[model samples]
Target: MLKPQRPLKLLIIDDSPDFQLLIKTYLEDFGIVCLFATDVVQATSTAVREQPNLILLDIGLPGGGGLLLLERLRANLRTAKVPVIVITAQTTDGLESKARFQGAEEFLHKPVEKDVLIDTLRRVLSRPPTQQA
Candidate 1:
């Protein structure tokens, strides 16, 4: 269990104001710290400086999109091993597999349910940082 003295942090990179508020409020209610980045530039800087325990990324953004961000994160040694969960509005086939291949450990469609969000977070956070990869 994560204690207040050492909370698990999640960086959510999305362009939606409503989503930012909703996710932040929900996660904070359960003692998880949430950071917001509305764009690629901010997301990159925050990921480097804050070094959040997890990243929840949205694929549709103003700039190069979430896939590009995921690639960048994977290339950067500092954040390469951090678990990234991709969330998006699209429900196209093979999206999840592609996300995993591109370095996202999980994928969620838009309007993510509270229970699913919490469960995924807990499960991923509880896993060993480096498995037999």
Candidate 2:
């Protein structure tokens, strides 16, 4: 008999407890298992250890910022190819471009719209991992 598949795992790297709870609720509605990391150190360690299917990263995180963490994630072979969707409250010019340049599969604004978030997650998960140069 074929083995049962595991639930999809999504690592959420953000410093806000309220946002975490909110996002978790949204993702749980779709049957996704959520993991949390509130800082860059924890984020890297958890990501390396858990090997989540996807990552939702917040750009304003304390301890090193999300852009730096994104670079580190891309540099590490274990986490490099895991799709990242950057979620940020910041509206700074070029922030989205920067995240995209760093390998984020999608960029989302804060006060995340439930439908859009879910749709983006599904779309990103459905595609094959792009071969990194």
Candidate 3:
């Protein structure tokens, strides 16, 4: 008999420890393995090592911001096609457009509604690879 594949891995890149805890707790029931990174350096390294199925990125990371990291991720073949959702408080002019143009699957505002976050993630994950960024 063949073994079952593991559940998807998710990485959350945010500066807040509390938010990381909240995301972990909320997503645990979905059978996802959650990883945290408080800054770009760690986020980059973790992304390379873990190669998560999805990434929830905060725009205002320390060392390097989400946009920079997104660029780096897009530049790398291994991580370039991974789906990413930008969840951030900094929803300024054109940020969402920029995020989408930079290859984010979605851009969600901070204080994300629990249902919205879960639903968006589910929808994104369910789509075919051709439809994903």
Question: What are the lDDT figures for the candidates, one per model?
Answer: 0.85, 0.89, 0.89
Candidate 3 colliding pairs, count: 0
Q: How much is the lDDT of residue 22 in candidate 1?
A: 88
Name the 10 consecutive residues with the lowest summed lDDT in model 2.
1-10
Give the poorly placed runs of model 2, Cα more than 4 Å off.
Answer: 1-4, 131-133
Model 1 C-alpha lDDT per residue in residues 1-133, reported as the tens digit of each score: 4444677789999999899888887776668888999888899989999988899999987678898899899988788888998999988888788888888988899889988888888777777988401
Cα RMSD for candidates in order: 1.8, 3.3, 3.2
Task: Please provide, for model 2 over 40-121, each residue's C-alpha lDDT reduced to its tens digit, 9 standing for 90 to 100.
Answer: 9999999999999989999998889999999999999999899999999999999999999999999999989988988888
Q: Please, what are the lDDT tens digits per residue for candidate 3 over residues 9-122?
A: 899999999988888877777788888999999999999999999999999999979999999999988898899999999958999999999999999988887788888988
In model 3, state the lDDT of residue 57.
97
**Model 2 compared with the native: what TM-score?**
0.93
Segments in model 1 whose C-alpha atoms lie over 4 Å from true places: 1-5
Error (Å) of candidate 1 at residue 48 is 0.6
- List clashing residue pairs in candidate 2: none
